[model samples]
Target: MDRRFNKHEKLKSKKLINKLFTEGQTVSAYPLRLVYLPTSLNEANTPVKTGVSVSKRYFKKAVQRIRIKRLMREAYRLNKSTYFNNLTTPHAFMILYIGNKKPTYLQMEQAMNKLFNKFINATHKATSDEKNT
Candidate 1:
């Protein structure tokens, strides 16, 4: 409800990060790819924790990588409610910027919107299947 990206809402645990990359489901919208896994940790309070990454292979410069990551984070922060509001379980998410070139904020936002929609649908389907099983 605060709609603010806070410290506690950030994915920081090394173990969880490793698990997320290794075991999470992925959804891609061109320049943006989302890796997410349903989590039980801190389920009663925080429903989601997110991290953003930009590949060094694409952006050799740290500044460029940081800028891209910042853009992705801003987009996700602004639009996360669309994905989070419908979530019945907690999740850890990694938003990876996979473009060869830097994207405009508008472009990143659009991609993020698509990625979030895909993620929401996938999550809902998974939850429903679980319920039916």
Candidate 2:
């Protein structure tokens, strides 16, 4: 696995971000909530475009928020290949840090793994159901 979150994989479009919040489905694992929307992207080969967000309302300081975002991104970078590489279509994902306190890297990673597993099961189950019908 490449184990890198490169430029093209970063979800930076303002219009897509807005649409995701309105139309996306979520899978939450305590401190982290992943909001994902199935969408077509210009990068046809990348299966997922991802963004990480730390709420200023919870962290209050820019430094704290930045740290959280970094941690979230690191966690996602490490876990992305195992959980996301096999998807058949492109999707946009925004991972939100919903916890109030600062988190250690291990905690962030564990939560990320759980969050991704939940999302995979949800999406795969829905797809299998569609095929069955």
Worst 10 residues of 2 by lDDT: 1-10
TM for every model, in the order presented, reads 0.93, 0.96
Where is the poorest 10-residue window by lDDT in model 1?
80-89
Which candidate's TM-score is highest? 2
Off by over 4 Å in 1: none
lDDT score at residue 106, model 1, on the 0-100 scale: 98
Highest lDDT, which number? 2
- In order, the Cα lDDT scores of the candidates are 0.88, 0.93
Write model 2 residue lDDT over 1-133, tens digit each, in one string.
3798999999999999999999999999999999999999998778999999988888898999999899999999989999987888899999999999999999999999999999999999999999999
Per-structure clash totals for the candidates: 0, 0
Local distance difference test, candidate 2 = 0.93
Q: Candidate 2: where are CA atoms >4 Å away?
A: none
